[model samples]
Target: MADLQDERPDTGHVPVGPGSLGAEDTPAAPVAGALDRAAALLAVHPVADGCNTLVWTLRQSPYHDIDTPDTGVDTDIPRLRAGGVGAQFWSLLPPSAGPHASGAADQVVSDTLDQIDVALALVRRYPDGLCLALSADDLVDARNRGRIASLLGPVSGRTLTDSLSPLRAFHTLGVRILAPGGAQWAREGLTAFGHEVVKEANRLAVLLDLAGCPPVAACRIAGASKAPAVLSNTAAAALNPHPDNVTDEVLLALRAANGLAMVTFDTARTGDSLHAVADHLDHVRAVAGPECVGLGAAFGAEPGVPRPTGLTDPSGYPRLLAELLDRGWPESDLALLTWGNALRVLRDVEFTARAAQHRRTP
Candidate 1:
């Protein structure tokens, strides 16, 4: 743990990573403690047969508490790891400056890819004890063996700059899905469509479709993750209306594509703020058909940040599932929203990538 309390190394202003592992990084197996807790949850809730305890992991690297002032104040490193909280997949954001003339967002995509290369190398070296799960099935398998998975994605989608090539670059680097906006849209514009909208929704649609971007994959502590961008979803209800939430035009847009529509709700934020997004899901599913709806829990382990008015964290996931059940969502339909659909996207990518690799080798 490097005596973190006394040996607080002055790295000026740096983001969290392996260094934060602190005392927990000891060979004594800090994960063992988290395993013990998972054991307890498994004993009571017990992920049902053929069921999965989801970890809708996010990568808020640059924006994590430390940089956010009020949040970085006295974070508990050991406790986070001990809880075996949803796998902390490194959600690396790109740099604001330095790189090419193609524009700032594309530059970040390149820089972030470099960081991913480093992270991947570490996982490859410690496959037995580290990983980057590409699918929920991979997460279930890794949990059975006691390892963490790292899902790859940018906290914001601005890195693509309304371009297809950048999205391709990120996908090539194993970044399967991404959420387009963070507090607000990047240098681009507002995330939600408004009475007098600024950016083009069709452009956002083109970028997501090109990236095959979705929140279907998370990270692991050992090897690589596997998953897909099965469908596109957004939680930008405040500044932007969620097209995935459903309007005839939006529903037609989503229905036209073969993917899922995810409604991500930040428990730390007021749930009412996301109601527009949620109700849209209800309407979209009703009008577009059941296969299109999905859900996301945008939770942050950092303290002080309030959980959305309705949820309590990963433990609260099943409650939402129950709500969907109450609303007459079939078990099969709920499964697709909760895990199945995401897994299929990942598996498809893995299969496609491997097939291409095989063809190249031969």
Candidate 2:
């Protein structure tokens, strides 16, 4: 709320097609004073970011670099605390450059594990600032304690070694979200192995991420109906046909499947400005419903990838919150956008998995 009237981007009425939350339809909350209300809103509702490459965030420090792995100099801790981020789905990305790219299955597996190790090690280095969260409760508890709950997730399904064992192993290593490998897996919408994995994930409560892939047959069956599925850091093609936007058909499928579509902030994928971000969100809300919306903000933490205006860092989150409020978004719905929905989905996935495990225990 830092004099947002001046700093805030002009989020004018974004005209969307049928099924969208039109400007006139958007409802404002009955709260006095914008800044105080925004703070109060966050105090009661924890802000959970759907996607962030925190490992890269750590590298933002001059003392660290990917070529050299040293957890000495720090930035992410104080930064996140200042930003008011409660929980984050920290993506463990395999090396896509240099020697070990995701070319072979073995490389993907090994690199993925290495990424996990680094991410966990970083969390371990800052115990007071960050907590390794494996469940929905863990995330909430961490936030309650004024610590950032860190959840580990693989950035690619290709790292699974084409087997279920590795997938289970990752789960055991505290991965509660997954995106299974293969383009053909989505051909029939869901493949046999994909179905098996989805059932296992459902039974285990591990959330499946579709990345930006359309909510195809597999997404419809596994994500929409069975368990919580996330479309992380993808764009909405209906608004902007950027490489990252998901098609209108996919957005509809996501709604039908009850899946969540997280909007990213990287301008390369989402176009430019916070308004662009808002447009995508409005489109998704209109077509897929607000429950299907979450903020990924793919703030790579490092450089190279340009961030959208008005939302340059973790702290810029309040700007988005304020903008949504200005657009007449209700507090209850705002809570869902910030954290509630993701937590609910995670909890549902966890409960389903635990129940399945309980049934098999006998």
Candidate 3:
């Protein structure tokens, strides 16, 4: 069966055999074995990205140059499919200056808009390989039709200025997630205006991603909350009891609020091996339950983020899965870590936003 669904107009070519690389369906000889093995694993279950995985634009930055030279321009397309990726939360990160930086707000906004344009252009450029997923169903449909579904979100609330207007504008432009930092636990939490934006995001169903920041007191606040909060990137310290990491009090707050802490493959945060990454996942699951653990590897997109040794690129996901399996992880639990938990959160946010919109329509 095709990974994408009928609603999406076919982009071109039908995938055949194992390791189909979409419209540019070319798998290098050396990687064929890995791709072939990954194909079998993915065929049994869909693989959806729980965080921003595709940031093709980072390759253009002279200062970054993160990917290996062999992959060529926009090389992630083939690797993503070959690795059995079904959906991705492609990040639209603005190359803008922060409040203390030299750039102006207008400049930041312009940079952000440019990122959005690039993302949309990629969708247009690789319609056969990618589809824009606005909802959870779109994600499933895209996978069924043999296409990788893509969802866009800002890496931080800093992308939006001090108002909900820009937030709404982004939503209109197809962004469904927001990572607001002013509400951080280490900080005093959201300012009055920030609180308004969070409320609007909840009403609009835009997911508020903590991105592994310390859990804020506001995250525990009931009525003021909007959408199911998620920690899309974090280390074990952020979710468990540790002197160097987030306090046990913070961990309990996250669990009490029904939030999630998605694990990342960044070695700097998760130690030096795939085993360490698995350890972090296991810890989160042990403390927060399987439903609260998700994948936010942030691979391919983060330029400076250090990846686990041996997990060289997107293709390394299969190895990570294999590592987890070796650790006696159940297949059912693995599925939840890979995509299920994140999907449930996305669905909840989308449903709430749509329901609120319907109420306001009349």
Candidate 4:
């Protein structure tokens, strides 16, 4: 929630190799052809980036326009198109407790509302480029129209302010994803109230993102919630021992719950190269299955943290996919990683919400 600038130092290009592939490996593709293949694949299955902090950057400066090219941040319309990003989950990370944080509960709620306003306003401001997507169907519709499907995701459960009203309100306003406060949930695990939040999110068709959650809490939420959960912007802790990364236990739980573990680009969580990212992706796919892995670059989310080489911004996805391609990932699996899997989770959540609505009162 601080002023997020693109301060990542340039780590030169790291070549893709067979070393990045997991147990179920295929013969590596020629590196010269991988980029072309990646581009061709992306034409149909554009990247559905799970988390981006452009809203946070926009919130910092009134002059910053999302349509502007090279705004000294990670995301922009032109670069997004260049990156083959068809759908994006715009992360609204309102600080829960900070020196600049609101002391009162109402103010915190107000701040959350303000963040949503910023996201909605961007879509309204750029109707030709971005369209608000509330469901999986909407994402496809937007793609067909040649527009970027924008999904709202308010990170941190504290944004709800210990009540379900705000959660319902966020859903009504087109928020589709809710990631509970990881630091808080990690320390105490999901309390009774947290379970209520998950249940209500399920009913509302809001995807639960377990980005910063620990294994115990992530597994519990995955087990309890009918809808599939996601790690919107996290790496595999099996490779990187960071607190924010997803553990193998959580990955197995995702497999059982049909959830997604979107591999992040944060070098602090994963390692600092394209191959490091591929390694994490391979690990997640090997553990959680390829259906459960996706991309959540989390670009510009942590301003000072180092970004992986060739993945410093929105235009870098094709290169990352090329790395995967060179590592011998099939086109079908790559399609799921880029688009299908996220859409499936959204569809599943909507289905679960409809079923819950038939049985329970809102």
Candidate 5:
């Protein structure tokens, strides 16, 4: 396995300036109207962002309170509300190196549990602003109650320590999604034990995340898992050669498996412009259809890292949606991109879990 440090982006927890939250590329009058329509649309069908590294950010900065308007990271309550986020999957990435690295299985599990504690603690600290969501119904309920539905995802298959016990324990603790591997797993592919993780995840109804998974492993998991796999935070590899980006082959597999590829906003993976971000979305929709497309955004980059123009933080989602609306994307398609598709995948995973529970024991 590769170091977890190399597998994911930096979780640098820098305080964001309040001014940065409102910054955006100015739009023309016609485009401005589209922006209004975009905001209104999101008000009804908000974004279910597939991934955010906020939990890691908070862990790194134990004192930073996300309730503050400017928590220094890309995400905070105000920015999430401004971004029209209804549901967010908080990524719980365990240490890829250090004592917790391979052979220190107990340490890795402890590290993962600590990350989950941070997430659950955040939800508890701000019940009005966030709610722990374990099912598709819970997600919708949180949205209706005006809270961002918080879902937990533990990245890296190694976190399981070659056993199913940790996976079940994490689920019991309210983790709904699992990225069985990160970039390293994409390169090495799943082991026999990894395949068992996928099968058990399906039985538990946990959605498999393929954000850092490459084509071969992605396709293999898609075929092997009963529930739809999700690219929690990725862009189109066809556009950019970023290792974390998804390939056309994987996108096709996602469509076949009724999965979703939630496009990311990381400038390194997508591009530096708002149009560049939209291009990846357009390409994914072109190949996998809109139903397979959703927003992951992947916000919370280290400070000073370049973010896409007009999408500097979580609040910039409206601009991206407006860009799509201006490009002739129908509201219905945008609705699916923002919220419906992710909800549908969660419902499917829950249904699969229920059926699997009847057929197997963990």
Candidate 6:
């Protein structure tokens, strides 16, 4: 919801609402919206005593001047907290680097590293309210202490450099996880679905592991526009046949990285439906093993004001989970598919802490 603008001009591709933001809007507006949304959401789904939920950081960064000398001066964050958003992370956007670049992904990573000074200033500004959070464990400590932990993460993976400096810099900057791929398919080896068909998507995936920025989710997927409304994405499930959906190679990318892959169903992309995502997820579990897969809800945009599909935004997760379960899914298995998978991946990552388990009720 920051100052993000889509490269391609699509109607619903990047929707804007009262809480949404663009570069033109006053910087304060977006941050305030994020805080309001995050706080409202958390209030409804308060984290269990020891559980964790990360409010996307990029959702708040676009408003701040990416070119600011002191990126750490957090004028926007205070507004977010006032609205109830306790945590946020920096967004790694290629477009944010300004037009003209050798490579989209490369530019994003390079520019992101360049902003470390700003991030550091933030750590000092609100040591308790904001800290450079790097692992799952850090999230717990921050939340428990009533402070927001800033888990650093790349919004997408295409920005990584061949030298892995971007990855190293990300770690140094306190980014706890990485998406490793975005809507656009850059020249990286085995590109993510439908954004662009970059042949180099595969090479970069390997680089992520070698550099220690192992991904925590799958190619952030967007389902077919004509897909089924069912919670399980099935239409595009022909093993990533559709460019926007996860192909066999893409699924393998997550498995190889020992990362938890997530299938993000827009539930509103008219071009590609999400039925395939649901179907392929079952297939992924069959092939990639049970632990390496999950789902992400990038459902903030209001397609005709909460009519994108039958369900609403993130608030619709419980209903979606119910549908998946009714289709013969086990609750335990569903838990992982829903959130546990991502939680476990965070646990293994460095600079993060393991979540304390709650005792089972008799």
| Number of the predicted model whose TM-score against the real structure is largest | 5
Best by lDDT: 5
Q: Give the per-residue lDDT digits (tens) of candidate 2, residues 1-362.
A: 22222322222222111222233433332233544566567766757888877664553343453222223321244434434568888887644511223366677677667777777887787778789998889988997787788888844555543467777788888777776534334434666766666676677667887773443553465443366677767778877777557777777766776677888887877766766787777787788788888878776454445666655655455556766777788888878877887887788777777777866431
Candidate 5 stretches with Cα past 4 Å from truth are: 1-30, 95-103, 182-189
TM-score of predicted structure 2 = 0.81
Q: What tens-digit string does per-residue lDDT give for candidate 1 at 245-312? A: 22344344444444445554543222442233345456656654676555543333444444443233
- Ordering by TM-score: 5, 4, 2, 3, 1, 6
Provide TM-scores for the models: 0.49, 0.81, 0.77, 0.87, 0.89, 0.48
Residue 264 lDDT in candidate 3? 68
Report the alpha-carbon TM-score of model 4 versus the true structure. 0.87
What ranges in model 1 sit over 4 Å off? 1-107, 114-130, 135-140, 143-149, 154-173, 178-248, 267-270, 273-281, 301-307, 350-362
Our model 2 lands, by Cα RMSD against the true structure, at 7.8
Per-model tally of clashing residue pairs: 41, 9, 12, 1, 5, 47
Q: Write the per-residue lDDT of candidate 4 for residues 1-362, one digit (tens) a residue.
A: 01011221232212222233232322233365776677678779988999887787778765665575643565677667767889999888766522123456566667667789999999999999999999999999999998999999854566654568878888888888887744343335677777778788888999998776667778888998999999888888888898788889999999999999999988798887778899999999999999999999987442455787666676677778888887789999999999999999999999999998887766
Candidate 1: lDDT over CA atoms? 0.38
Predicted structure 1, TM vs. truth: 0.49
Q: Candidate 5 at 106: error in angstroms?
A: 3.4
Error of 1 at 359 (Å): 10
Q: 104-203, model 6: which lDDT tens digit per residue?
A: 5555655566555455565665565565655556655665676655644343455543444554455555554344343233333234332221112121
Q: Output the lDDT of residue 42, model 1.
A: 30
RMSD of 3: 7.6
RMSD, every candidate, angstroms: 13.1, 7.8, 7.6, 6.8, 7.0, 13.6
